[model samples]
Target: MKKVIVLISTYNGENFIREQMDSILMQQDVEIEIHVSDDNSRDNTVNIIKSEYSDKISNLNINKIGTGAAAKNFLQQLMRLSESDTFDYVALSDQDDIWNPRKMIAAVEALEKSNSKMYASNLTIWNNSDNSTQLFKKDFPQKKYDYLFEGGSAGCTYVLTRDIVLELQQIIKNIDYSEWPNFSHDWLLYFLVRNLNEKVFIDGNPYINYRIHDQNVHGHMNTLSVKMIKERTKLFFNGWYHHHALHYKKLLQSNSLEYKILDNFTKSYFSRMGVLLKYNFQLMRDNKKFLMFFFFTMINFKTPKDV
Candidate 1:
């Protein structure tokens, strides 16, 4: 049996933590050891894990990051795991999502079959309010610069080989967290893997139940919804996107063609439009999203500035 280490970052997730943990424990055909980091949950999340799952988990740390920084919580786990060599694969987990019994095994098999270092899969979105379920497709063909704009999928569905995890550990060590903007860990992982020219396999099948609720930090089922569009527009205009692009460029420290293209796109509004025209703005795999990206670039008036 292959050993897998699962890292879970929790906030105030008392309502669904049991269900999620149960699903993880039920994963088949892989040896499982869980590591959990809590961000000062005011609820019974920590208590439940300790009283119920103490024997099942490998380690648990109650890091009181009162600011609810999920990305930091996850990254800290990666840094800790860098010291160990017991696991063949590392997977990220959210406190609220339920994994399928075959999630880990399927990911491991896919990675081995495709000879890829990183893996991400589509998910089933479960809306708590309506009690509805929908398949969220993220298996679109990989675009040339998709990682520059969006993550391949949610972080919960990501599985990484041990070598990839070690590489990410080194990258994290070099990153200055104080200056690091609030970027999602999933997107950063995808960017690093693709930017470094590592092979990644995106599975078309859904293997996790992604719950959407009132307390969701970043959950959206409809990409074309007005709410999502407005949120994306706000981020684009507020220099969030530009700031990330520039920061990633600095981290790469490369004169490669891809980085150069990203640099040109971040230079100015006109240069961004030029890049969009050059590629027909196909940075996004979905056609509608590409159109939206074009619209956001066209109306972005603020010049790129160091944040």
Candidate 2:
């Protein structure tokens, strides 16, 4: 009898929005309501939702910023929801994915049956062009850096407990999304949940059918193992690595209690800002992941002279 609300952020998703909505309405073991925050879709995305699943929707907010900021869109959706305590849990949904009938049931059961404050499950990625399906990733992640370098899991599969939802509302008031435009909403939440020692449940079974296409924002899911070592190396060497680091730092700074706790992690995690910000390969010796520091930048015979 758990009450759950699915927060969906939609763009021009008319092609599959209706089919997805049907699957959402088919979820079991929970009372469900859908609240969509659409980023001013020019197509019939809103009309499709209204016409196809009017009974399934709870709230709809239309935004005109047209920034196509999915993270900000969802963050705002969560903020709007934080004002009330009507629901027991909240799940994230992408407008285009088809949900398994038991998605909500498994998520709620996993959290209630255990001490996990948040829930994320594996999904089968469906390729549109060729119509192929594959596991999002073969392994279940356990490390802190895994959450960073490799996103812990798809954000769309998250079912957050009430406490997690409350903290999100509190911390976001001080966070500026512009600071890290590409910083992932899922990774940010996963980082805090782990660092705060909040119990997290990661179900191994695939629960949703995640869609992958040329236009997907985070479409790196071609294989279970991230075999793109070259791309990963670029991520480390490029300023993106450090930029992401700063993104976490800024969020941590916003919550004093959280920041104080994060201060307890290996100091190297906090001290790499200089190398990251400067993209200084010569300072690789200063970082714990010297190879990564080197690979991310200054990968040649000699490192940059420290300035």
Candidate 3:
């Protein structure tokens, strides 16, 4: 029996929303459902989620929006409380993470034994000032053409698939919020469900106690310095190259043969250079080591996995 809906979203999560609502009401079996959308959190985090989820919660009030507009207004109030109801899954909580009572039963047995419509797990980075734990093992790269430049897909350890959240609510009702790309809302639902291949990657440990406070943004972009890491690495690679050139210009306006061979070999290797464009046409391009690791990752190179 599947009917999960742990969708959360908040702002001032009053001291780890009651240990993430008692590890999700001490999950034992299933039939879960808890939605809380509070962007107006002037602190008590909406009176501790209305004194602890006032009867299986369902609150929304995107105070002064923006955080992907309070996650597209909490996915349009969870698609209007699932209209005439139906919920095989729709998790994406993070009011100060805690999960892992088999994190929604291992993301519903890896999205019902993977045909891959969406699933995510393997996270445990809980450092709350020294109560350490760092697991982060989400391995997926067995390469199905490297899932067309894999980004997003870790919105607080995901698990979606009410038909991929109604096909991301019809791609967020034809998105164009000023031509998008402010990035977030799990990288725009991991760039439209991994470019419609529907993505899935579960391994284990869904417990993500990642409440390393100071109202984390990108979890303290590696304890900044070196000139705020060269101005936050050129504003995080110019907002990841404007959301990877707006998802590779919507995969070359949907003509997609892997973005027409990665946009004709990244526009013929940035119009030629020396050494046969450095070791033969960008190493005979076929995801040439992720386009020379995204060309020293869009110029602002400096690693330690660039935090």
Each model's number of backbone clashes?
0, 3, 0
The candidate that achieves the highest TM-score relative to the unseen native structure: 1
lDDT of 3 at 21: 76
Residue 261: error of model 1 in Å? 1.4
lDDT of 2 by residue, 60-166 (tens): 88897764678778888888875455889999999888999999999999998987888987789888888889886523535433443334478898899987888
Q: List the residue pairs that clash in candidate 2.
A: 236-296, 237-296, 237-297
- In order, candidate lDDTs are 0.85, 0.70, 0.60
List, residue by residue over 229-299, the lDDT tens digit for candidate 3: 56555654555533444445553454765555444433432422222243333332235444554564445
The TM-score of predicted model 1 comes to 0.95
Q: Which stretches of candidate 3 lie over 4 Å from their true place?
A: 5-18, 21-23, 26-86, 92-127, 130-154, 157-159, 165-189, 192-194, 197-210, 213-258, 261-307
**lDDT by residue (tens digit), candidate 1, 237-301:** 77767777877787765777667777888887788888888886458777777887788778776
Report lDDT (Cα) of residue 153, candidate 1.
89
Error of 1 at 173 (Å): 0.8
Candidate 2 local Cα displacement, residue 298, angstroms: 7.5
